[model samples]
Target: MKKEYAVIGLGRFGGSICKALSEEGLEVMAMDMNEDRVNEYAKIASHAVIGDSTDESVLKNLGIRNFDHVIVAIGENIQASILTTIMLKELGVKMVTVKAQNDYHEKVLNKIGADRIVHPERDMGRRIAHKIISNNVLDYLELSDEYSLIEIVANSRLAGHSLLDLDIRARYGINIVAIKRGKEVIVSPLADEMIQKEDILIVIGAVADIGRFEKREMQNDY
Candidate 1:
């Protein structure tokens, strides 16, 4: 069955999610206290309504409990975000993802049983910092505080070698899950698969281990 999603607070974060989900042909309900914001998304979302999600009665009337997932994206109003998340869980929302304003907010959401907590600003900053600091790191995705998935471009030092020859896993505790060569992608590359210069290696490992691998393999003068 197709999952149902509702985004409360028609701000940039919530509105972007509603549009992206709807673009993928998913049913999305866009809710907000501002009539203008709700109206703006009426044509984009499956359903758009102006109401305060923090009010339990409002959520009940909107049939929020039937949605598979609800995202609390209320801007600035920390109290409203917390109350809305609480109501959503109390009403048996299958998944409640809340956006945290800070560390304290995330702690509260975690204690209250939020299915997921997102710190957009903090996560984005980490991504940008990785790109700025590493010449070989093409991209980065944080799987958790301790682990990450990184894309690193192979250079002369890593070229002309195979997975078995490098023995990267034994040394750095990271896995090269895939290799992106121009337009083709090789997933779960075999030990004999040759590493070519400029190939994008999709690597995953603990953050500290990845950093160590980067310092030793990717950033050293050859």
Candidate 2:
């Protein structure tokens, strides 16, 4: 059976999610208070409705509880987002995800039983900033406030060493999650797998340790 998802907002974030879900062949219920926005997505989604997501009666009437997951993506209005998330949880939706505009919004969503909180704008900004600052840093994803997954090029110092010789975890307190060699990716690279010049190492560790590895060790390589 196709997974059913309900997106309760018609803003860019919510609309993009609805479109992506539909493209992925999932059944999506796209809801919005604006009639025009709902009609626009009605063509793309399995069902699109004009409704006030913050209203409990409207949610109940839509049978939102039957959805596998509900995403509250209302932008600007933290009140509506929080209320909708709470109502959805009370309506017995299996999972609820919310797009938070800020830290306070995220905290409130968490307290209201939102299963997941996404900070799309903030996360993207951080990723762009990191890429701008370090030419060698290809990508970055924050796993937690203190930990992250990073991608950095294998510089000269690491060109010929095997995973066993590097011992990243023991030496730098990081793990090489994967290695990208040109177009190919080797996940969980084995100890015998050798590193090559320009290989992009996908690493995961505490943010501070990754900074150390990039600045002190990798940058100084000849």
Cα-based lDDT at residue 101, candidate 1? 94
How do the residues 1-222 of candidate 1 rate in per-residue lDDT, one tens digit apiece? 999999998888888888999999999999999999999999999999999887889899988899999999998899999999999999999999999999999999998889999988788898888888778888999998899999999978899999999999999999999999999999999999999999999999999999898888887737
lDDT of 2 by residue, 1-222 (tens): 878999999899999999999999999999999999999999999999999988889998999999999988998988888888888999899899899999998888888899999999999898887777667788899999999998888887888999999887898899998999989999989999999999999999998998888777665767
Supply the TM-score for candidate 2.
0.91
Model 2 alpha-carbon drift over 4 Å, by segment:
182-184, 217-222
Q: Would you list the C-alpha lDDT of every candidate in the order shown?
A: 0.92, 0.90
lDDT, model 2: 0.90
Error of 1 at 172 (Å): 1.5
Which runs of model 1 end up more than 4 angstroms from their true locations? none
Question: Using Cα atoms with residue i matched to residue i, what is each candidate's TM-score against the true structure?
Answer: 0.93, 0.91
